[model samples]
Target chain A: MSLLAEIAVSVLIVIGASFALVGSWGLLRLPHLMARLHAPTKATTLGVGSVLLASMVYFFAIGKGVSMHELLIVLFLFLTAPISASFLARAYLRAHVAPDVLPPAGEQGWATFARRSDDAHDAPATSATRAPPQD
Target chain B: MSDAGLLDHALAFGFVAFGLALLLNLLRLVKGPTTTDRVLAVDTMVIDVIALIVLLGIRQSTQAYFEAALLFAMFGFVATVSFCRFMLRGRLVE
Candidate 1:
């Protein structure tokens, strides 16, 4: 490999590794579950995405031609990261979050908790409705 | 220093740093305040493991590990989705 290509690969690897560390740090430091969700879903995607990019570049530099398949991992992660984040957010809202801390459920009554509100008097929304306003 | 030696040193540094990140993720998984937090930590850990495996493949100059990374990604996504589904519905499939 040329010196320039080698340097590029090294730089990519270091950047990717640093981002991974930062993501994990955020996970530990963030105080709330909702806030913590942001750290892993976003930072880790960039972290591993770049590492795989480095791997792709390194292979190409060594003249075995690019490993086109590595791109699939990057693509897959990007597509699924949002799905996981949304699922986790919904799960939190339904299972643990107080609705008053949320903006008004607006017209539809927050799709995730709709069924529960109809049957249970102490359903999530009812409790939120009774609680004093949170600043 | 020779280019190969320098590259080797950099790769080693990356390995250690990522390993530390993996450990931190484990700590979060254990100490998380809620089930949602633990699930989030585990999801992040799987992604870190995937990154580490790819780096290992790079250091060894072997494409063999690529398939392993791909499989891990698939399984991790499935696990995350199933866990979320269970948390949402209280059943894996219903």
Candidate 2:
């Protein structure tokens, strides 16, 4: 290999490494599940894409011919990451329903248990209240 | 130093930095608070692994590394999808 080619390959590696570093940084720095999802989906995708492109270049330059394998990997990644992130975020939302949104505990138990118990005990009384006038 | 020498140095430094990044991602995978966070971290880690495989393919000048990258991509997608479905429905099977 010529000197220029070697230098180019080295430069490509460095660029790829920098992208990986930034992606990792974003993963660590982002706060909250929803916010952290953004980091890997966006930064990491591009970062890995660049590195794979560099690899494609290095291989082709070395007379390996054009490689489409990395391209396929990139396509699969682009297709899947977003769908997974959205599913997870939705799951998180469902699981984290606000406590304030729930009815008070006593009211809930009364409505759930006491109402049924009262209906069972006061069947005739309830019927009398409902009967218009069975004279 | 000659150009070959410079290139060798660059490759070494790049690999080192890439390794560091992989480690950082692994840390997130280990310590992530929620299932979603861990899944995200794992996704990022797998992407980094694919990149690393490509780098290895270049560094070693072997076509076999491409196969690994391809497999990682395929299986990683399946894994992510399954995990997401599990999180959403709380079951892997409907």
Instruction: Please report, in order, the local distance difference test score of every candidate based on alpha carbons.
Output: 0.83, 0.69
| TM-score on alpha carbons, each prediction | 0.89, 0.76
Q: How accurate is candidate 1 locally (lDDT)?
A: 0.83
Question: What is the per-residue lDDT of model 2 for residues A30-62, given as tens digits with 9 covering 90 to 100?
Answer: 787777777777777777777777777776777
Least well predicted 10-residue stretch by lDDT in candidate 1 chain A: A117-126
Residues B20-79 of candidate 1 have per-residue lDDT tens digits of 999999999999988888899899999999999998998888899988999999999999
The share of true interface contacts that also appear in candidate 1 amounts to: 0.66
Model 1 over residues A1-135: C-alpha lDDT tens digits? 877777887888888888889999999999898888888888888988888988888889888897876899999999999999999998888788766566765565566655542233433333323333334
Runs of candidate 1 exceeding 4 Å displacement: A116-135, B1-3
lDDT of 2 by residue, B1-94 (tens): 2435676676677678778887888889888888777877777788888887777776677878777887888787778778765554446654
Number of the top-ranking candidate, with DockQ as the measure: 1
Q: After superposition, how far is residue B20 of candidate 1 from its true place, in Å?
A: 0.5
> For model 2, what share of native contacts is present?
0.69
TM-score for the B chain of model 2: 0.85
